[model samples]
Target: MAFVKTSGYRGLHVFAPITPTREFLDVRHAVIGAARELARRMPTRVTTNWWKEERGERIFIDYNQANRDRTMAGAYSPRPLSHAPVSCPLEWSELAQTDPHAFTILTVPNRLRDQGDPWATMHEQPGSIDVLYSWWESDLADGLGELPFPPDFPKMPGEPPRVLPSRARRPD
Candidate 1:
């Protein structure tokens, strides 16, 4: 179904509609490159799926002085969906065979936020989307972001240890 018809999220799907300026795009590319490097360093494989939008109610992300809008591209910083650069939605899903707690980063178009029936165009070809970004959260928060790994966490070649030798082996 079209993402627009969806309502508020339950569980851990936190929708974040990001409006990227030319500058933001540069940052995103850098981040993506870094993630790729990190994957190579770690044992777990990491991939990204970038999404784009082409529909109603364009997302105008304001990122300026935090107060008065000194938006990028001037008034066009958050231009209409039609005018914005092609956005790439990068979704990262981490799957570790040894790790029981796995989470997914869902990147989708702003269309998902529409309260009305935005899926009407699914039958026909849809236009460009308005918003896109990744949402990362834990499906199992019981002890998420705060649990200890096994004593012998495998370390990939060339990868640095999570802690220095001194820290890994508590100073006695």
Candidate 2:
């Protein structure tokens, strides 16, 4: 797994490369499975909640990022913030001590030359998502059903409504 800091953002991106043998939905299921397990193990510290209002102070694991055609900033991509912080890949050893603000657009190139890419071998071996599929099935059986999709995406069966929970009309 590669741990990265989205400089100027509130969360970390944890990535593990998977074999490209499945469709986007299948991959999403795998990610959701992993995220659910993390939330289960660390209920107070993590969340898979689709809405920020529900997420509270927990770190949100965005399994929805697996959705097809979705775009995301890549490693070293500079954020639009005034400080120009880059989406920096982190070395596990340094992750605890490093500050994201220090890896701005002006500093990353020299850091890269000195340290090399922390994710250089990320694709040296891709794993199958089939193992995670079992967890997804377990979650389904436990009634942890589909999460909400992006508002512009076509409606998916079993998805929670796209409206924010605060705005949704409560049943009388």
Candidate 3:
């Protein structure tokens, strides 16, 4: 898995390179499928819940970022935070020991000279996302399906109702 510190933000933006053979919906489905599997495998640590109230203490996947028109930063992109933190790339081995706040506009130059670029060959061998789509289909058969979209997007087919569970009108 590839992850970058989001300008010293509390969370990391995680993703992988795909072959770019699918459209938006298909890619989203794959992401959801993969996230579900991850949540299942590491139930206490990860989640795919769209609603913050339901996520409990897990690290949410934020799969909605898979939606079209999403915005994300690449390695070395600066964020408009007070300390001028940059979206720093990471090696898988060092992720546990690394501190997001340590990299910034002033420090990254020295870091690059010391460690080289972790994302240098990221796109060299694009992998198929097809297996994740297959996981999506399997999930569908098991009654798991599309998730809720953001407020600005159009409702999608097979999507669960937009209402939050706590606020859904109950039968009288």
Candidate 4:
């Protein structure tokens, strides 16, 4: 299951499952597929800023974090950045008004005491990505294809050319 939380100021924070096989390509595909589904379900527009341009509006999926070396901050873990903020979980309704910076290592424990863990039942029932993978297949059949992978990784099967769209050769 994927849980998306608005970070109030930065952007959306997505929490998704990771399979033990650690296949980077599969992870990337699943995340993008889920993001597309999320955009369709959400009330707002979404876009991926791969080219660093204002490409209209869309739910931007930061897929670079899907790589083998990167990770989203775990719940209750303190981020190593300047303020030492913790990755806290909140009710979806609380997200809009909550200040992320206030959930530091110092305050998380007290919040947990007062309100209890929002994700306490997260593991009670596991979720499968079968639906998302099915969506990927459906999209492929509809001609919506692969997005670019990170430059450092090997060119994946079915991936478009690694060049930025602006630099790619136009077909005659």
Model 3 per-residue lDDT at 54: 89
CA lDDT, every prediction?
0.26, 0.84, 0.83, 0.69
Which residue pairs clash within candidate 1? Answer: 3-112, 49-89, 49-91, 50-89, 50-90, 51-89, 53-128, 53-129, 54-128, 54-129
For model 2, name the residue pairs that clash. Answer: none
- Report the C-alpha lDDT of model 3 over 1-172, residue by residue, as the tens digit: 4535553576787768888899998999898998998999999999988888888999998778898998777678877889888888887777898888888899998989998988887788778888889999999999887899887899888788888788989999
Per-residue C-alpha lDDT of model 1 across residues 63-99, encoded as one tens digit per residue: 1112122222221012233323222211223211212
lDDT tens string, model 2, 1-172?
4455554465577777877899999899988998899999999999999889999999888888889987777888989989888888987788778787888889999999998988888898887888787899899999988887877899999988889888999999
For each candidate in turn, the TM-score is 0.18, 0.92, 0.92, 0.75
Model 2 spans > 4 angstroms off: 3-8
Report the error of model 3 at residue 40, Å: 0.6
Considering lDDT, where higher is better, how would the candidates rank from best to worst?
2, 3, 4, 1
| Model 3 worst lDDT window (10 residues) | 1-10
Candidate that beats the other on TM-score, 3 or 4, i.e. the better one: 3
Assess candidate 3 and give its TM-score to the true structure.
Answer: 0.92
Deviation of model 4 at 163, angstroms = 2.9
